[model samples]
Every structure is written in C-alpha cells, then in structure tokens.
Target: MSSTLIPPSCGRAIAVRAGGLVEVVDVEGSQVGDLWAIDVADPRRWLSTSHTRDTLEQLFPRVGQSFVDQRYQPILELVADTSPGLHDMLFPACNPALYAREGSPQHPNCADNFVAAAGQAGVTLPAVPDPVNLFQNSAPDADGRIAVHAAITRPGDRVRLRALRDITLVLTACAVDFWPTNGERCTSLRLDQLDGDGN
Candidate 1:
C-alpha cells in the first residue's frame, strides 16, 4: 500500500481504479476530514451526499453500505470504520464565507483546499459538492437541534472505503479551529491506497 500525508489544513486528490481501496487515517486524535469523490468517466458526476442520503434514507454513513453519485449510481462503499462511527453528511465543507461569518477571514478552509487540490489533479466541476465529513461528531438532538462538537476519534483511527468506479478521491484535513469542530485544534490526516484484499 502507498500512503499520502495530508498536512494540517491542506487537501489532496488521488485517482483510484475500480475495486481499489483507500484508508483514511486520523494521524492525530480529535481531527475531522472532509471527503469527496469524483467519477473519472465523467468529471461532472460526483459523489452526492444528498443522493446518497435519499437512497439510504439515513444521515450517517454505515459499513457495508454504498454511497451513490449524483445519478444515484454506487460509486463508493464504506467497507470499514475504526472510529466512533460518527461520520456526517449533514453539513457543508467549511469555506471562506463561513469563517468570515464567524469573525475570521482568509482562514485555511477545506473548501478552498479541495478546489486547489482538485485543480492540481486536472479535475474541475461546475460547483463544489457537499463532502462526507469523516470523524465528525455532530448529530441532531431530540428537539432536532444540531449542535456541532469536537471529534472523539483517537490517534491512528481510520475508515477504509472501496471504489465502485473509476474515480478521484479528494480529502481535506479540516481547518475549523474556531468552533468545537476538530477539537478547536487542527491536525494532520493520512490516505493509504491499499492493494487488493486489504480487508
């Protein structure tokens, strides 16, 4: 297996063939990573959180469940999770506007990092898609109030996913330090492109 280190507050895009696997490693504890997948056959097609939610009728990802693309086609599968199993598909990737609204401006954000990294990978899209927030701990309460909290993932925790199609995977080590997200401290992540039968 080959690994890619996603430095703190940075992002990277990698291409993986169908049936290939990628392991998202939380190199440090209490960190969040925003993840996206783009179909190589059609760059315009992407992993759609909304579509996946509609298909699965669930908000959080589950092991053995497949995530679909914009067209409702399975593009990725959550094969394993070693964390608290709190991955979220309810929020958008942190952006510049989000930081500015929170009294901070020009902060390193996952949205920008994703765009830059995707560009370097020669993949462009009409708009930024909502990412699956890995290791995120925010969930709706009894009254339906969603309060974001810090991730509880321990160091070396990881989620392993498999590609159902030729695609480019984008991952950003979340940069949200102002709120409880990321435990108010940013950290690094790792992407391990594993060979066959990694399970």
Candidate 2:
C-alpha cells in the first residue's frame, strides 16, 4: 500500500488502479475535503453529484454505495464512511466567484485546487464539476434550506473507497475559512492506496 499526505490548504491527484482501495483520513478534526474522480481514459466521464443523487435518490450516500458518473456508470464505491454522516452534495466546490460572492475576493479555494491537481496529472480541462464535500457538516432543514455546521469528525476519522475502474482521484482540503464547513480552519489529510489483499 502507498500513502500520500496532502498538505493543509492544498490539493492532490492520485491514480488508483482498478480493484484498489483508497482511504482518506482526516488528520485533524473539523476539516472538510472535496473529492472528485475522473475516468483515466475519458476525463469527461467523471464523478457526477447530480447523477449520483438521482441514481441513489438520496442527498447523502451511505456506506457501500457506488458513485456514478454523468453516463450513470459506476466510478467508485463508498466501502466505508466513519464520520457522523453530515456530508453535503448540494454545495458546489468553493471557487473564486463563490469567495467574491461571500465578500472575499482573494481567497484560496477548492476550484483552483482541482485545476492544479488535474494539471499535475496532465489533464487540463476548461472546468471541473462539483465535488462531493467529504467531512463537511451541512444538510437541508425542514424548510429545505441548507444549514451548515461544524464537522463531527474526530482526528483519525476516515472513509474508504474502492475503485471500480482506472481513475484519477482528486481531492482538496477545502480552504473555506469563511464558513463552518471546514470548522473555520483547514487541515491536512492522508490518502492510502491499498491492494486487493489490503496490503
């Protein structure tokens, strides 16, 4: 197994072979990580939040749930989720526009991170899709308004994903300090790529 440490307020892209397992660890409590997966041979066919939500018919996926792309093809499966299940799919990845809208014009964000990570992997596209906000605390209220809260994850809390196909997984340690989505402080994370035998 190989492990990679993503520095705080940064992003990274990892190539996971088929049948391999990728584990994302929250090095510290209260940090959120934005996750995305792209088909290695076809970058356009990437993880789709809308399609996943439509296929599952649920806002948040459960353990053992498979995440699909825009074509409804399975990409990665959520083998395990140890957090309190407070993730968010409604909120788009944090970007410069979002920061400007929030009255912060020059803040680092996940959108840039996605681009940087993908670029590092030699894939450059005009735009990246919205990501699955892992470890984030947000849910719709009774009136359907999304309520953001602090993360419930403790240090060492993590989630495991199984790759169904050759894919590049991108992650950003979401640098959103303006909101409680990241507990108002961002932290680093760890990613481990394990073989089928859990090596």
Per-residue lDDT of candidate 1, residues 57-101 (tens digit): 999668999999879999999999999888889899999999999
* Cα lDDT listed for each candidate: 0.93, 0.88
Give the Cα error of residue 156 in candidate 2, in Å. 0.5
Give model 2 RMSD, 1 decimal: 1.2
Candidate 1 wrongly placed segments (more than 4 Å) = none
Worst 10 residues of 1 by lDDT: 56-65
The sequence of per-residue lDDT tens digits that candidate 2 reaches over residues 94-182 is 88898899888888889999999999998777687989999888878899878889888999999999999999999889888867777
Question: TM-score of every model?
Answer: 0.98, 0.96
lDDT of 2 at 96: 89
List the lowest-lDDT window of 10 residues for candidate 2. Answer: 176-185
With a 3 Å backbone cut-off (N, CA, C), the pairs that clash in candidate 2 are none
Best candidate (score: TM-score): 1
Q: Which stretches of candidate 2 lie over 4 Å from their true place?
A: none
